[model samples]
Target: MDVAGAPRRFTGQYYEQGRDIFTDVDQNTFKAVGEEPVSTFSIDVDTASYGFVRASLNRNVLPTPDAVRTEEMVNYFRYKYPAPASREQPFSTTVNVFPSPWTEGRKLVRVGIKGYELPSASLPRANLVFLIDTSGSMNAPNKLPLVKQSMLMLLGRLDADDHVAIVTYAGNAGTALPPTPVREKARIAAVIETLGAGGSTAGAEGIRQAYELAAQNLDPDGVNRVILATDGDFNVGITNSEELKGYVEREREKGVLLSVLGFGMGNYNDALMQTLAQNGNGNAAYIDTINEARKTLLDEATSTLFPIAKDVKIQVEFNPATVAEYRLIGYETRMLKREDFENDKVDAGDVGSGQAVTALYEIVPVGGPRAFGERRYGTRITEAARGNDTEYGFVKIRYKRLDSPTSRLLSTPIDRTKEVASFDSAPRDARFATAVASFAELLRGGRYTGSMTYDDVLKILGKTRGDDAFGYRSEFDQLVRRAKTASSMARLGS
Candidate 1:
């Protein structure tokens, strides 16, 4: 799956024009369970970071350290977790504990949330507003061309009853097409084909117009969403990320969500894309090739366009008597305060139909190899957990149904019942996730990976590729090799 178009040096960083913006985030550190036993973070289903990393590798460059988001990388590939019995529950949670392949005496705890899958016939009408960027910066072949084609791919997925609208911005914003039924597919495609790149970017205006269109055509029973396709270059009108996020949030409150599809390289603004998506109650994805467009728009059409659950938050509390230390593998930015889980006013990530979001934690059990020494003068371990000493942790999830503002809670315990005999005996999905997380960690300087190497990553990937019907996991194998090459090239300063 050559998701990146024609390669430059590695993939997404061919130009090196030095305008790509990614927020530098620090790696998570292990904490003694006795000190802070609770871990809280929102569920992230976005795959933008993985696509960006792959694009960089294809261009012969290893991704910038900040560009390697372990959570997005780990969540990019679909895992075969069991679905909820019904939409009433919305999602199912799966937990597994296995030995950490990277180091001895440590273990990996996997928490997976698989959203309920809905048959196409059961989905509500889709009210989609295509907010496209036609800025001069998007003139590159991979930018606007792919954006237009990506729109077509999504158009092909909509039902006749679905509605489509187009809003584009360069120096200014304008509607290329009004809200039209998918029954008029030819009209929609014709409008998309006519779109071209030129002039400065007025992305904020484009978003406003798109959201307005969606709002005006609000379907009480339909899923209304604004899909923004851009290089994330907002050169004109309300370029401030916070302001734009606030704007998106306002519209989200009115029932119109946003999803950003980033394209191109060098000058991409992944940070802004994330801000918009995160606040707009949507997800961000990068499309570097037609294959990626297909994966995001066609193959995962329902999941990409119709969210089944919103404001989903996960909290895990380690039993101090059973676990000594633990640290989350990714989602550094989505971390929430302990009280946010039950707060309906607090915003969190949304889960789409059939979307599976997985999170990993590296933990040291009591009497296991500890990452940090016991707090010499800290509070002593208590007997409060005496009855729960057999449990490694407790997992709690809070989520709201698509139509509700109130949240509900679901929980399960991570105990011996969830532990695998060894890494080799762990679920393939869990192993594969760990492999991806390890690879991402290596790319980000391997602060915690210790002796893990590309070879080790390949070893894990080789054994856990599963029956990758879509070849997604097989693609990861190639990416690992590409990363190795890119590392060598970087060392030589090629």
Candidate 2:
């Protein structure tokens, strides 16, 4: 788990200088349903946390607690939710409650959202700018070289109508390839292959130039986006986070989206990359290997590129009659004020085509033991005061169209009747997601995981890993085993 040993696994030699940055945020705590019945937060589709954890474990290192986001880990795997029947709604919802595997008398409620799918033939033309970082820090094989390989995988899916451009930054930013049609595949491939790594990183300049090119050769009715591939080592210019965020916000108003593809590890600036991607109306993902590249760029190409809805936010109201205390599993970074949910100006996450986003809440029902503490004494509803025995809570979602400014609202009731008799009886996807979420909690100090151990996680994952076509679920199982071993060794060493 030592940092000094990491580079040896990937390369024989190691560099002593690298600046990786992450933000420290407080984790969510339990809430009394009687006092605060409503929980509001924005949707997050970023998968970087999962990839970063995988990279650290592969190097025999345990990821830092701050690096883990439980929600991202849960959403990394696809859930078998029903897709939306029409584009008018853009997404569908599936809600279910099951007995908690980790805690007795507690329940886990899952909210699943699946976006509408559009076939590749029906997908709009793409106007993409590949913003690459070719800095000295990216000299390793996993940095710039892997970026080239990842881009090539994406090229295989592009059509004749799609256009691509390449932009790189080091001491300065410049164009490596002008806007070219996808029909000129050989030319694009040649340009990508010739890219090399050197010089200091000027990430700000690269971002500006890439946005300019995307705007200049804009496809008015197509998917206009800039994909930034980097280790996120921005040393040269505009290092101030607020300044960079403002710049990205302005460009986002110009109808250009920015999706970040992170590479390498030692000097990765995850906080900065995440900020840019979130404010620039895009999703951020870390590409640690060629297989991850294929998963991001090819298998989930539609979800990665074609966004069906923007500013997606979710809010849940727990009935005091049915619940005592509840806590959201993760999404600490995406928490929003109650009023922000109704405010159209407040920016939030985007839902891409055919993507599934899941959220889990741990709830203690009325008369159940208080997991955190005694509930606040207030006006209590009697059985006669409760409206319906079947209704648990209400869920509301608000989102805007890709081109619209105003937002529309969707509301549904979460029924207690949908609760399964046991965790073993829950759908495979729900059980598998819970397993991943629990695993994350354990890695991040196990604050809310109760009695869940690494062995329990493995058992749950092994039993519920249903139909993993690409072996992502299987890979996750291996990761848990590796993490268990690393954690045990660390404890023994201490």
Tell me, by lDDT, which candidate is best: 1
Off by over 4 Å in 2: 1-18, 380-385, 489-494
lDDT of 2 by residue, 38-124 (tens): 999999999999998999889777877767899989999998899889999988889999998877888899999988998767899
Q: Which TM-score value belongs to model 1?
A: 0.95
For each candidate in turn, the TM-score is 0.95, 0.94
Worst 10 residues of 2 by lDDT: 8-17
lDDT values for all models: 0.88, 0.87
Instruction: Evaluate residue 344 in candidate 2 and report its C-alpha lDDT on the 0 to 100 scale.
Output: 97
Q: What's the CA error at residue 141 for candidate 2, in Å?
A: 1.0
Q: What is the lDDT of candidate 2?
A: 0.87
lDDT of 1 by residue, 149-240 (tens): 89998898889999999999999999999999999999999999999889988888899899999999999898999999998877777876
